[model samples]
Target chain A: MNTLFVKAPAITLRFVLLLLISTVAMVADHRYRVLEMPRGWLLTVMQPIQFVADWPAQRWHGWTEVVAARSHLLQENKALLEINQQLATEHQQFAKLQAENRRLNELLQSIATSSLPTRYRLARIVQVSLDPHTLQVQINLGSQADVFLGQPVISSAGVFGQVVHLSRYSAQVLLITDSSHALPVIDQRSGQRAIARGDGPSGLLRLPFLAAHADIREGDLLLSSGLGKVFPAGYPVATVRSVSTPVGEKFAEVVAVPVADPGKVQEVLLLWPDRAVQTIEEPVTDDLVDDQADDGDHE
Target chain B: MNDVANWRDGWLILTTLLAALIIDSMVLPQFLGSFRPDVLAVIVIYWSLMAPQRVGVGVAWVAGLLVDVSSSGLIGLHAMVLSMQAYITLMLYQQIRMLPRFQQTLFVLILMVLGKLLAMAVLGMTGRLPTIEFWFSLPASVVFWPLIYALVQRWRKRALLPS
Candidate 1:
């Protein structure tokens, strides 16, 4: 036991050394963007362990999905078919409207061309944070593909989150449902606008600053007003679940549910629109010149 | 070296950790998730209490680091809190062993809460404090403590039985 005392200090020293090493790693990581290489290396080494860690849960989820009652599956299938039919009809109308909008845009382009460079790519969700407190998701795309920091992330439903950290082959998305995340949104129906913030795993969103008499109601859809320019206009954000106006409180307490179901989404599209069309005269391809020559010959 | 070949004991601990990680990640029943037990924490605490010579602050630190990496948070935060918890548990092992099962569980439950609170405090100071989910998970951990204690105890007893 007396000898154990001497070994104890040695163990503590070693432990402190490990702590110092990790702290230095973290600090260096934060201080310089150049540290990204080592961080990527660490993530690559850790990827296998992460896969092992997630295997059981993912397998169980797969099993449950398989064992679900046939009747329930049929019911879900029917519901999906109905929803698909409705969407198909809406999509046709949307296509026509889009064509008209494109024509109008072309006419406007004759006058001026706005040159805001934006681009996007599709990525898959590789993992989600287990701790409900931190609503974050990891995507498989990273700096290798030019995914910059602070890029807005969205889903089919609406704005999901923004890219906070980037690595070589992966990036961490800060979900809008995260406590630290907030977005500017406006009610699509009433045109009243307010800031929407996450209320944590209760899966609720709150619009904290609305006048007591604001014409908002349950089921009102909130959309991105594009005021911040981070989010594109008219993306569905949330639906008002409840509105509370307590006497003497200046702001009405508005609770909303996010349009995107964070748990189930597998893939997301990252949009990066072209800023300008740079004309580069490549040595004209033989095939292109031949086609043009053929056209001239026919004329 | 022969004792290290105790597959039954090693496998049980591995399975328990796997299950806990799964439950922590997945969308389980609302009540269960809300009061979800800290499986890894309980396992580390139990091992440190029962076999202080084998499991120590280092093992706890590694486990906590894994949890931190698995979750999206500051890297060292969980590792630091877990080492602190293991240290306290090791110091109090003798007194804990003497207590009744229920009393021991309660003592450990307090330790788990302390660990969680400490982690939250570290996160808060770092400006990474989580929202309401942080507060909700603490009480939920306490509520699930008894079942976790019983499950670990049963496994320990089963492993100790000479085959």
Candidate 2:
């Protein structure tokens, strides 16, 4: 018998004690959030580990970019240039319409509800959640970059998610596809408001609360309603894929596919909604919208 | 162990644990994501069996805490599961040490499956119970165990050789 090993009784005692402590911690973290401060400090310590883990993947991406065919790059550039020109043409009309809407809002004295100008910062995805059940990702931005809880995250395609946990150098984003996530969205064609809840790893959103007789249909585009103040209004979210109304059920089973493909997105934009419109930052001019789009491209 | 040997041993163990954490955090392809093994648990179980006096329930608990923080799950979920796993491994290490390699792999599968079940239970408590595909990790970890065991054994032999 090895005398060096801990006694069985001692092992049992330690196990029970540690189990109790961890249980307390789980409750504190989940219900009370008392562990947030310490979690932040631990995440700061973990930054180096995360960086080392991400290094190989980042290098592989860089290598692929360097080795990409010239023809492929040229094709991508051509397509992007075409898209840019089309957007520029649309912005001319959009700028004029925006000015007219602002003037009309000012005349009506109901200017509080308009979707204000937004500021954006680019971020790279550093780490995705290890748990298959939890739909969250950690980005390379945090409190150090003025990122706060509930900041909206968007890809060039559409709404992606929002920041949920913050450390000094990194933040965790709860993807809009997590079962626990829900967004308030408006049907662009019908102007009907509904809540879009995530359907876990299936990468679909569910409109569970919509009544059976609701005026929703397949192919309807959903946009952020801006009712919750988390996502900005007018940004595309998802498109309804299927709607089935059972004969006896009160709510229709509507499923929509998110516009932003979470699997393919490597970069995302963190948005800062301009809360105070104290001074209309830029005068109404055709160049204003062009400048805004250019700034977004720079990010 | 002398001070120098002890210091070197500590570094070896820490390096293995850090490697496990790094692997745990790496993003797997979507098709493979659900099948990724619980690498940290496997490492903790190995250490608990090989060096029970040095890496027991306490070490397991700390490792689990790191996993919880890294995975951003409820803070204590993995901690509770891993500590429990370590405690059981410590108790059975001597008996299991006598088993052949194939049986040992089977034992690891059982241990890891139990840990997965416990994790699923905790997630269920929060109403986030995963789909049946969550069990896919069992076969993966089972396949990974022999490689890790061989590597760690070789590492231990080199670093902790007697004077």
* Top candidate by lDDT: 2
In candidate 1 the C-alpha lDDT for residue A203 amounts to 71
Encode model 2's per-residue lDDT on A218-245: one tens digit a residue: 9999998877667778889999999999
Candidate 2: list runs displaced more than 4 Å: A1-3, A127-129, A276-299, B1-3
Model 1, position B148, has a per-residue lDDT of 69
Cα distance off (Å), candidate 2, residue A214: 1.9
> Per-residue CA lDDT of candidate 1, range B24-96, in tens?
4444544555555566777777777766665678877877766655565556666777777777777778888
DockQ of 2: 0.67
lDDT of 1 by residue, A116-213 (tens): 33565788887434545567787778778866555677887877887655666677777777655677888888889898877765677888878899
- Give the C-alpha miss distance for residue B136 in model 2, angstroms: 1.4
Docking class of 1: incorrect
Categorize the docking of model 2. Answer: medium
Worst 10 contiguous positions by lDDT, candidate 2 chain B: B1-10
Query: Interface RMSDs of all predictions?
Result: 4.3, 1.7
TM-score for each model: 0.65, 0.89
Worst 10 residues of 2 chain A by lDDT: A290-299
